[model samples]
Target: MAVVASLTDRKSVQPGIQSLVDLVSGGMEQVNQIILSKAGSNVELIPEIAKHLISSGGKRLRPMLTLACADMFGYQGDGHVTLAASVEFMHTATLLHDDVVDESDMRRGKLAARKLWGNQASVLVGDYLLGQAFKMMVDVGSLEALRILSEASAIIAEGEVMQLGAAKDIATTEAQYLKVIEAKTAALFAAAAEVGPVVAGESAEMKKAARSYGMELGLAFQLVDDALDYGGSSADLGKDVGDDFREGKITLPVVFAIQRGDDKDKAFWKRCLETDGIEDGDLDHAIELMSRYDAIADTVERARSYGDSALKALDRLPAGAHQTALAEAVAFCIARVS
Candidate 1:
């Protein structure tokens, strides 16, 4: 409820993302059509499970990034739409898989597909969506685009595996955590943005710039989400506050708190995280420790640093409305916590 309320308030003050959404509305409509068309199947369960998550209230930001990046380069082809759908499918598949892996009950403010349907159904449907995604990519007929996305898929899986190994490990270093997110999250963002330039036949420099922008933006996005898990309300997060804490996730705030804490604080983290012995008031204590060490603030500052890198990445592109929207998009990602 608080996340919803926060979203309502944010809508009045945040026009940056809205501007980008509006700018890409026509293309998004096409992407939506493609998504719906591709999500259909002869088996009723496939569409049922796929539509459950697809119709959920995610911003579809990755696909929008694809559309905007291609438009920024003055691409006048239908390839962007198909590629955008591919990006969305890839994202959706990951979400389904991630929820299962995380044992999460909620996603986009609804019961996770794994909770409603069995994990097997969720995973199989996710695979189906991925299959459709690759088909769409091949339809685009750009070997380079297909290659980038396919590589990203493998990297994302590796990231998830890395997180599995690192979960509840209080000793996880900042570097290791960063590597996990870079692979798990930023890779897709990078690939999504890069393919736009690839489809448009843009130069290597422009493609690299777009990829850099997406990578940094994604880092900022996930960092903000990490900070919000402790400080943000359920409405602001779309999931319960402290979900990461409950899951014993080794997020940036947790890492910072551990690093800055005294021996007693380390003991506390070990009890709650390493052993998964969380109890009432533990989340509050965790938040208090994070606040004492300025962990949340420091995390937001780090996100701001990444946001700056994202903006700088845009410098390589010629000035245009799409470019402006993309820059604003980066700012918006960091602004969620602010």
Candidate 2:
């Protein structure tokens, strides 16, 4: 009888996200258990709505980062598990809120919670998850962790408001868009990575290194997602390919294209984005213009630069499988676009 190699071994043919997932699988299992347990509620509607999105096939990358960072610091306590779950709950809450705000129809390749349960339930359930998340953080007895996460929560809310104002505004600058994503997406990631070392009693320098790694990784991840909006398949995006375009989101591609476009191209963007006067062929034309201006390629190049930063951030940490896997994770994020 022939014996088959483990999936991890096969995946090791190339160093990528799967290797990171394998490295952190033990801790991630604990995090998953905590996430499922805490996601339950006495109120029937809460679990129903929460599960709709929770079970939806997100990579759970943020929580996994918390687990990996803690493990890298030799943390053996259960605090990282609880904190990882808390990070995920915070993320899920934001997603529920985001779908409602964006008026999105799908999430993770399925109908959004709002589409099935209405905006009220989505918002309320999001609130409930957030409350539970805080409860867990408090239970961990890590005051510093709680402070970091709470601040991230406030920053994320601010980012949402910033995005709301920037929407359909073709004049939105690249700096403004970067600011929006830094708050909305990267803040939680930084907090998640930072808290791991805090709980592990690691040095402040190590904590800063972890935080830097996560922030740069998050930026690269979002930039790739933004570029993929115009160039990737729905299978890759887990939502409609042109959802950002339809929503009048001023992503990096749009920013670059607008900056470099001529008079006719600017007018076209103004109609499709600013006035919400999108026509049938507008998406195709928008893609054409973005391609003509090399917007997608430039956005991808920016993501790669951030990916480089993330790898450098990991250089401060001690050498180990976890650190190597974390660096590979950064490579994997950039590879998503490639």
Candidate 3:
């Protein structure tokens, strides 16, 4: 525990999001305003629950990606702002639904919408937010952007369903779990970045670059998160540590641990996750086993590989302050677990 803990707490010299935030702050203001205005509804609970998660302290990274990608390519219209807000709405809607689906009690260091308002209200508000997201996308009037986002939405749902099917199934393979995160997490990231060039009328080559950067960055982001579930504090994830283990999620590290662990270890995982028979010391034991097997270290190593790929994708774009900030964003994301 101490060794992994030390690694997570070690100082990261990598660049942070300040550059990215400075670059996108003006546009993000517009995105925020649009978000608040569109979140309103006649139904009181809708606004209540929607605002709860919306105002939570997520980095707003996906929307920022939209703004940065568009700005880097000189997108001059306000359409990018609308689309950024739409991206955020899509993300918020997913979080709301995810909390319900994962049976989570917390989000962003706060009570989950489902915890405060029932699962039904949380789900309905999530639906409302999704509807709002599409309406905003339609208002942008880019059929290509609309198509990209709509398809991403469907893929994300499929990822969720796939995850539901995989949960607590310790037999879940590493490749299968990657498929889940690629769909559930990376799809929106790809769409968020690709739509920027789609709306900005950049060449298809640039669109491909942006999508690849986003998809790779998203994979690194989620891989880091999987590692952090055991190695990081609640502050890093904005949720209780070990939530994945408690939920029986077959994250990358769990896959590695299971493959490398012995029969006694297999029984332990089955009891804690498969059968929900966790005891007081189980989380510590889980972390110990993961450490013994280098599961967490290997997961972080895989994240760096994806992070490197994200940087390579960035190299395909024009070099400038925006490009630099976007590049630093990848490093910053991976640094979260450092």
Candidate 4:
């Protein structure tokens, strides 16, 4: 709770980013309430499972992007708040299911939903959250919004599926890896950013700009996430290091390493994924391979490129405190380690 309250107090953020943070903070309260109410009183079990992930302090970046995108388009209607919350619910639902699928133990610095509630409860509550999310979107009464959200959800599912299949496959290329990230990670970001412009009735060009900004930023975000999995401080990242390797999940860093790795390193990389439950030393070895290939540095540069492209997408937004904040926010995508 203190974390949530303190997000707005980061002095390093520009005013525009602060405004978006404030709007997102206001919108998330309604979204949480809506989720609990929709789960019903009798199903206290399910609500508790949902709350495990919901109450954990995520940055609420997706919903914040939605609100900021809406704000950029001069939207004053309250409908955006409902939609913003809806987007967050959709995101949380995915996280719940992802924890179950990945058999993950930690999220947001605590036990995962599946760990506390069991897989059955976690999966069911995840389903409930998805249903409630769509209903909230319906309450907003925009077919356009529905279509965008539905497409995003579908793409996200595809991305998950693609990643699942790619897991344990040594041949998974960087291009295929990028595709998976685009679907699983970038799709929701693009949709969240685009929703505001569509609802506010902005020009097609501006809507496209919003979409571009989000897609590029989202890509950068995921790349950084992969990089952090290998090199970041566990306390800062809120998850154990090398979870990706432990899960045998093929991310950009690994793919790049495999592509660029030397013969001895390549063979070692191959063996690492082939074995179940990576040894602690294997993580150090993996990092070494990535470092030698310069994959981590390359990944960071790629993230920076996307962050730059995200800033470019906002070129048309009128000069104001809000637009400046949005630009700073896009940069923060690469800056934040967590």
Candidate 5:
């Protein structure tokens, strides 16, 4: 992954994004425990898989974004808690479904839900979580919240389907890839951030700004993640390098590498990516070709551009420490690949 640029002492309006992070640090435990407790039941496989995946640690960044956005809007209502958890459940549901779609065996350095509990179980449990998330949203009694999450979920599904079709298609373009990432990853982040303003009854403009910020941040984050999959440490990232390549998933780096490579290189990449499995040294060669073409730098540059855009979206929001932290986090997402 790219190294997050130095953010210490950086100027920011809302450092509350970071402060919110600190505030919500221990709060997620309660959410997770509650999920596990309530999920306990007749279906042993569901609990097993849910427990395994949930226990595998995550930063709970989605919920943090939701809470921070609410707080930034001066919301003091306790309903933010349920909204936060709902966002997390939505996130976790996507993870379960994503792993199944990707046929991924590992997540957070542990067995993925599909691997541990079987694909059928993983898919069903993912659905269950989505239902639970909606139920919580309904409990919050906000039509805006329902609209945000529902629209996001639809976008996410569309993105996933688009990506699935895009994979291994040598004709895939950079613009198309960006669209896929925007739908698959950024939509959820945008929803997570936007829903907070919705819950807090912030002005339409503020909600739009928050949504745009998160959408840009999510794009930056996923672009960097793709770059890292092509050239990153499994130990550092908690996921294997070349995962995108291994799965025949055509990410930005691969698209760039193909576009930049010579005819022979292009042909070779085509064969490797289309085949069921890549041969020894194909990954290394791909990496070398990507390097020669500066694919990583290309991805980084794009991520940085989006990071700047995300910070720009913050301009319309209320000034506070949390906003600064959110901006810093955006910078960190892009820099993390360095």
Candidate 6:
């Protein structure tokens, strides 16, 4: 497919996620309403910090998954909307916390919340978002959905801690890195999708399939993001290129490069990443080393593999517009590197 080829070939036009966006538009409107309503607080700073990130132009993909999965089963209820909003809050909370933890300056092409509000405010607002999310979950009154999301929250936290442990460690293996992303990123995707079926009263088999789709898709999504941190421009990536490298984040491409590098290359990684002794030519040299090893290409290849698995998981779901859009969504994610 042209979209698959687009993983490595920028000239090929990608099939975008617009289809999924269109399919879930109505449900997303409800989700937006809930999000805005719930984000409100008498504490001025709470709403200020919360709305700053909430109003920022994230794609709201996780909540969209919840809505689409529920709608796929021909569900007709407000519960899905509530759950979708909760998923979004959980995601927003994570981002708020992530920016602070990563010491990031930008998000979605704008100044990160931490930059504007400071770390203490950003973290507190993130906690507030989580509180609002849990309250909404209880409002939905689905113990199963609550269980899935609560567990995901805890898993995501563990993943964050895992990433901290692996950070700047050039010796980090591919297996170790995978464990980090699977928990930090894919856990929420799995929960967002599984809750749809749970709220819709679908069978366990279908819920399992949906969770598989989401988990695999999340992995693909994150892998592509890792690739883009090196391969893509800021305009396309919504953040400065090489941010991961600058932050000493150990990702798949970095893992591959470190494994394949010679002693000199290894020493360079140690200086730039482990010791944070970056010089003027360091970023360029780092990119060159990754290119020499074909690290970015290999990382994209891995993402395509996960994307393939995500597409297969979609096949087990009910057939409809949602399935097609969701499948295309997988392709769209991987194609971002192009």
The TM-scores, one per candidate, come to: 0.95, 0.95, 0.96, 0.91, 0.92, 0.95
- Per-residue lDDT tens digits of candidate 2, residues 285-328? 99999999999999999998887777678888767778777877
Off by over 4 Å in 5: 1-20, 26-30
lDDT of 4 by residue, 130-234 (tens): 888899889999899899998999999999999999888889988999999999999999999888888888888877888887898899889999899997877
lDDT of 1 by residue, 1-338 (tens): 01111222434224369888999999999999988989999999999999999998789999999998999888999999999999999999999999989989989888999998889999999999999999999998999999999999999999999999999999999999999999999999999999998999999999999999899989989999999999998888878999999998999999999999999999999999899899999999999999999999999998888877887787777577787777778768877888
1-338: candidate 6 lDDT, tens digit per residue: 11222223434324578988999899899899888999998899998888888887888999999999999999999899999999999999999999999999999889998999899999999999999999999999999999999999999999999999999999999999999999999999999999989999999999998999999999999999998888889987778999999999999999999999999999999999999898998888988998999999999999988888887778889877788788778878877874
Candidate 5 at 329: error in angstroms? 1.4
TM-score of 5: 0.92
State the weakest 10-residue window (summed lDDT) of model 1: 1-10
Candidate 1 has an lDDT of: 0.90
Each prediction's RMSD to truth: 5.2, 5.1, 4.9, 5.2, 3.8, 2.9
Superposed Cα deviation of residue 119, candidate 2 (Å): 0.6
Tens-digit lDDT string for candidate 5 (183-241): 99999999999988888998999999999989998998899898888778886566778
Candidate 4 displacement at residue 135 in angstroms: 0.5
Judged by whole-model lDDT over C-alpha atoms, candidate 5 comes out at 0.81
For each candidate, what is the lDDT? 0.90, 0.89, 0.90, 0.79, 0.81, 0.90
Clashing pairs in 3: none
Better of 3 and 5 by TM-score: 3
